[model samples]
Target: MEQANQNQDYQAGDIVYVFYRNPHTQDVANIQAAAVVNHPEKENELALFLYETYYPLSDEVAIYSTEEEANQAYHYYYGEATEGVLE
Candidate 1:
């Protein structure tokens, strides 16, 4: 969907998210990482494979290489997500 379309113009080292399902229970996992692997097919949708270490979770809802980086970008973009640094 949007991931395949939007990824065409992005290059490696770019920030992106990969939509994946857990192998055992098939639960959804939202993974974010620097674009390290590229899949050009439209079905692939995303141009990169995410590095596992950078993935975020509920308790770790906010993630970036640096706190300053996350704060600078997403701090005020949305109402509900504007916690921590935005406060």
Candidate 2:
């Protein structure tokens, strides 16, 4: 019930920041804008249809629940806070 409520709270056009690292180099690869498209078919899931294309698409979405979480992940990975939202 709580998960369903959270999923309902997010709708199309909401933005989610995804932080990811390079597999080979083990460096901060990119911070991407993951636009929330809809709720996933599976329960308690967020679906992102848009994102910045830096590396090849892998299974690592690195999705965060909020902006603060995203920023924290960014800082942990890149040693700095994210600057601006990606278009």
Best by lDDT: 2
Clashes of 1: 1
What would the per-residue lDDT of candidate 2 be over residues 1-87, giving only the tens digit for each residue? 011123235556776566545567664466656677545554645566653323222244566556666666666655754452233
lDDT score, candidate 1, position 66: 38
Runs in model 1 lying further than 4 Å from the true structure = 1-4, 38-47, 51-87
Candidate 1 residue pairs in backbone clash: 4-45
Which run of 10 residues does model 1 get worst, by summed lDDT? 54-63
Instruction: Give the per-residue lDDT digits (tens) of candidate 1, residues 1-87.
Output: 111332135444666433333466563333334443345444433333444432322222333443445444443442234333423
Candidate 1 yields a Cα-based lDDT of 0.39
Give residue 32's error in model 2 in angstroms: 1.4
Instruction: Give RMSD to native, each candidate.
Output: 9.9, 7.4
